[model samples]
Target: MSRAAGRLKVGIRVPPCDRADRIVRTVRRAEELGFDSAWFPDSQLLWRDVFTTLTAAALGTEQIDLGTAVTNLATRHPAVIASAARSVAELAPGRFTLGLGVGDSSVAPVGLRRSTTAEMREGLTVLRTLLNGDEWEFTGPGGTVRSRLRDPHPAIPLHLAASGPRNLRLAGEVADGVILLSGVSPRTLAGAMDRVREGARAAGRVAEAVPLTVSAYCEVTDDIEAAARRIKPICATIARNGGAPFLALAGIEVDVPDVVDGVYPDLVHAEDWDTAVRVASAWVDDAAALRFAEEFCLFGTADEIARRLRALHADGVRGVFLQHVGSYDPPLDLIEAVGASVLPAL
Candidate 1:
């Protein structure tokens, strides 16, 4: 069952690694540039608090939607998440979305376990109940306690960021929306959506009614082959972590170490991206990187990107939040370039 195509909402991922005011300015700039939404990433050690950034963005901008590209449940308890989501919803009213994901950067650094699917289901149930101004029961060593969030905003949407089969199905079954981590590849996206639709059908929900949002790495460049070399780390990281089949769809093969040492945080969010690319090149060559870029990423000129985005919209992608290559830096250039050139063209 294919979803009927609709207007494609374009959003940008702004890492909240700077001061709250600076982050707000970036979001304001995005709004001025005609971008539909500005998404922020949450990593305690890597960036400033996501809620703090969202709070400032809420007050600074009047129109553009605001959301976490995602925050994780493992690092925060469900009750705390309820309170935070409620607080942000109050600030932005109909514009706030709370996106949750299995802890990656947030938990690995602290030696904490990521949320399991069962845990995610339980957490979503608790969050939904509390955010709707109802009580949720928590069973502990002492006894079962019931608590409800104050100043609840039932309008706040809960989006799940998922890439795996199980989590993707869970998002389809329970979430208000889905943040798809499978880039913009038609083949992989089709497979991921199949899993999602199966789950929604199992839950007796109309699969096409659920909102789909894609997260992809994007750049506005004429020299795509040269630019593709920078994303070698990303290509290798995805293949290393059980996404080789997705790459196989684009006819690219890579073999990376299960554990790649020397990168500070991880291969995807490595501090020295150049060194990371060099290391990953042992497995993923320039030709492979170019194929990944052409098939998976949005790396091309303005016209090229706009055309690709149109294709994605035709394929049932409701929204796409573009990410620049690096994790720490703000996508100011991307926002300006795509906002001026690509958005107007679209």
Candidate 2:
């Protein structure tokens, strides 16, 4: 698709908490609703196996594209990731995209950490080489796995889940697409696009040639305030440290306490609702949270959302991936509303 066409690709970030039946139903519903893509996250021991979930999602849907929003290179070698991506592409043909990231916050639970940006860049280089049906030789901790595509090459797009400046730049320089984390404000989005453009130019690629997909946390409801309150916890945590570069662009500051070194994991593993709210509130205030919710999320009336989304398109965003927070039913409501009411206007 032409960049000017500005596709409105809406899909949910499959939470690790969901059940198998629920996931299938969600994927099927997304496809029926005309959503462009559906992405499942990779968290291994923290959650279900990402490739397995993606296979199920792909098998459940007919038209919607399936992807990893992202699978980290820290856990699996690039060749292994390439093999998995190739397998999934075989299952869905042109409907699979491989979204890679450094790793998720859950890595800490298993006494692990994300790979550095340089490591991620090298990993992507390896992944791209393998995906393009080229043979690669590498020596890593796992001895050696020299390989090449023996089967028919699938048209699987490689997307990077980028939050920091280095990763975002690398994504623009190399990746087919970039997946911005949820809770990004318009200012942040614009700044990210600028960075992507800079990297693309440096790499001798047209700015618009590379697809930019912004993922946001959205909950559609008449009571916008209530929805904002519900979304605050998740957004705050993401804002604090997980996606700090983007949130910093939005002018939201995160005052993290020395006691709680990692804000995101602290919020995610918070024992109760009160603790969760406390943890999230520390990073994001009501005004900032509301602004982020309004600017990033597709909330309020369908007409209002459509109008805002059109404005976003005008601003240069190619597509969106809406992450539904809270209950599954609300996401279904938002998806149906967007497809039936908002997308028609677009």
Candidate 3:
């Protein structure tokens, strides 16, 4: 089946949990409720197997597309990743997408280094070739694998989760889509698109042909302050890690630490709730959160969020991956709300 076009697609990243039945139910609900896609996070040690979760989602959902938000080719060899992706694609045919990324701290805990751009590019090349049913020889520090698909192949779209300019450019050159991280502003999105366009130009392809996806935390509530409070922790952590540079650009001041060494304490160890609120307020305050929610999240009253999303479509955002950072149940409400009120308008 050909991919849909001309409007922003809405998707949600599935939570990592042992309750496969619950996860499957949520995915089915998301599909039935009108989300365009459902994504699984990749973290072998921290979360359940991404492939396994995706398989569950595939079985439970008939219409929604399924894929990894970002899986590292370094953790699993390119051949292994290709095989797993192919297996999942066989389950869902044209509905599977493979979202690849440079391996991060998740693999580091298991004594593996983060993958370099060269490695990611090489791995993507091999995976793409293998997915196309072409025989290929892949040799790395581990070993060599030479194989071709014996079964019928599926048209699995390959997307890269990219943030930096160079990575965005590479994604445009090589991938079917690019997934932008959370906390990006309109200027940042435009800048990233410029890099994507440059890469497409170099590759002799049109820039607009490549899909662009952005991931964000979302919440909807009448009490705006309460919603901002709910979103504080996640925003603070992201700010500490330099994920919210746009906060500074947006003229919001935050005492973000210069270096983030420890994991939990660096984010959670504050004097009081007010401190947490202050640290995160610049990026996650009611108005700021609402602004971000409007621009980045698929939250708010259905009418308001739909208007915001339509504006994003006008601004060239092809897709959004709504991430639930507060309570898990609200995401279900968000899905239903979007389906009942926003999707119809879209």
Candidate 4:
């Protein structure tokens, strides 16, 4: 299952919902649909248990890789995540990647905050050590203690999700792969990749040693204008979080409306997606939404999206995580669309 050095890979993100069976079906379908990986998001109170759903996916399917697009250290202990990751790795063998990140939706509603960059480094160190079956010092509440996994899974690929310069650098220096959150604009991707190279140089390694991926909302439709509008809320969500810097770098300006400020648990977590999309459309508008699609997202017809993806691969992106527009469940139709139209061209 060795990855061809410069080949592009596609993965799908599925939210585990109240119906565990549906999540399993979605993951299996993603596999059958020719995706390279199945990524699950961990937002416990908002969705089904990540590990539980992933376990089900692992048992029901073979061949497709699987992992968290991200889980966080604030909500789950590094040792625990490391152990849980090992269990999934055992199920899929070389197909699991442990993608870690600063807390987002998974923590915010519970009033937990993301870890500082220094804390993230410490967390990764702890997880990597424990997964190698070595004892590591754990510190928190009372005092520091040593812990280790009895039977470790040492070779699981560890990917880090990052957006800011410093975090991107950290990912380059330490991560086996980086899930770039800067979106897919050529300028933004170029800037983020520079940071990655900087970190790799600092760590005394080649920049190409680390793989890179970016997530994009995917839809295959004849109506370009409508699809552009549908991606507005997602574009707005990206704009509010560390996106302003990259937007400025790319000469793109998106107005973040006051209404967006009042949304709870983040815009992407809204259960009533129709309302969320409607509210987002006010600020995102037609011009800005279409512009966001041009610069950030991978939304369009199969041929158009595939051409853009090929450009990404040429520029060093090894993977793309295609996201569905809804909140509670996997968008099965979008999965089918990507499989039929985009996968072949890629």
Per-model TM-score, in order, reads: 0.97, 0.87, 0.84, 0.94
User: How do these models rank on TM-score, best leading?
Assistant: 1, 4, 2, 3
List runs of model 4 lying over 4 Å from the truth.
1-6, 249-251, 257-264
Give the residue spans of candidate 2 off by over 4 A: 1-6, 19-21, 141-145, 152-154, 182-184, 242-254, 258-265, 268-274, 326-333
**Model with the higher lDDT, candidate 1 or 2:** 1
Model 1 Cα displacement at 223 (Å)? 0.4
Worst 10 residues of 3 by lDDT: 262-271
In candidate 1, what residue range of length 10 has the lowest lDDT sum? 1-10
lDDT string, candidate 4, 1-346, tens digits: 3345558888898888757777888888888888888888888888888888888888888888888978989999888899899998888787788888898888888988988789889889888899889999777899998878989999988888998888989989988889998778888889889999899889998998788888877778777677787777777777777576676665556667534654555678887777777877766778777777777877778999899999999888888888887777677888899999989987
Tens-place lDDT per residue, model 1, 62-93, is 88889988898888888898898788777886
lDDT of 2 by residue, 1-346 (tens): 2113346665666654466666778778867877777777776655667787777776777788788887887778787888888888887877888888877554655677888889888888887787788888877789987777566353678888877777788889988888875434677677778788788888999978888788776555677876676666666566555565555566655554435543334564443545666667766777766766776677787777777777766777677777766422325766776678766776
| lDDT of candidates 1 onward, in order | 0.89, 0.71, 0.71, 0.82
The candidate 2 region of ten consecutive residues with least summed lDDT is 1-10
Candidate 1, clashing residue pairs? none
* Prediction RMSDs, each to the true structure: 2.6, 3.2, 3.8, 1.8
